[model samples]
Target: MPHTLAYIPTPAPATPFAVGETVEVLDREHVVLSVQTIKKVTRKKVKTDCGREWMLDGEWFDGESSYPFPSIRRKA
Candidate 1:
């Protein structure tokens, strides 16, 4: 079954995620990366963009820093 999400308003400049979008949570302190599937979690996590699901254990911020993924990169 598909997962349902909640609504949340994560402020702009922080909102970079979209529903059904894939993201990577960055672990700055430990230099580790965690991939996350984003879905609207709650109204608080909501933005013009969608929230996340399948979040890996790492550090992520919605409004301050860019989401990071180390293992994966855009093809050139």
Candidate 2:
């Protein structure tokens, strides 16, 4: 006899950002330039007047994935 394991599907995590929202980036304040949907995936574009910019995805901030980019937080 062979043993089998059950498979389950999980819901995608929610994003903590919104378009045109200001968030703290790299200890500084930045604005979310845009939120684009590409092939069913979400992408957030952030930038500062000093020319600091980045395009972030779920894996960058989600707990289940590796986070290698600067931390982002809601403006106080």
Candidate 3:
């Protein structure tokens, strides 16, 4: 049987994020991590810019399918 993957949305930005980009989920402090893209965007919605705004329903290395970071501060 073929394998199937579930979908989940990360509470981060939805538009400016890129594959293989390291970002910091900003809150009280900077929490840095790396991200890898697994699928293409299916749909999108413009939401608030508070913290979790740029991410979408996708897959990551954390064994979860979605943007996990709430608010990322991209590492430079």
Taken over the whole model, the C-alpha lDDT of each candidate is 0.35, 0.38, 0.37
lDDT tens string, model 3, 22-56?
Answer: 55444322343433222232244212222233434
Name the best candidate (by TM-score): 1
lDDT of 2 by residue, 1-76 (tens): 9955432222222554455555544311223433332222134544433344434532234433434344344444
Q: Write the per-residue lDDT of candidate 1 for residues 8-62, one digit (tens) a residue.
A: 2222333434455555333323232444555464433422132432222212434
TM-score of each: 0.33, 0.30, 0.29
lDDT of 1: 0.35
Off by over 4 Å in 3: 1-15, 29-69
The candidate maximizing lDDT is 2
Error of 1 at 7 (Å): 30
Between candidates 1 and 3, the one scoring higher on TM-score is 1
Q: Show pairs that collide, candidate 2.
A: none
* For every candidate, C-alpha RMSD to the true structure in Å: 14.0, 13.4, 12.5
Which window of ten consecutive residues has the lowest lDDT sum in model 1?
A: 67-76
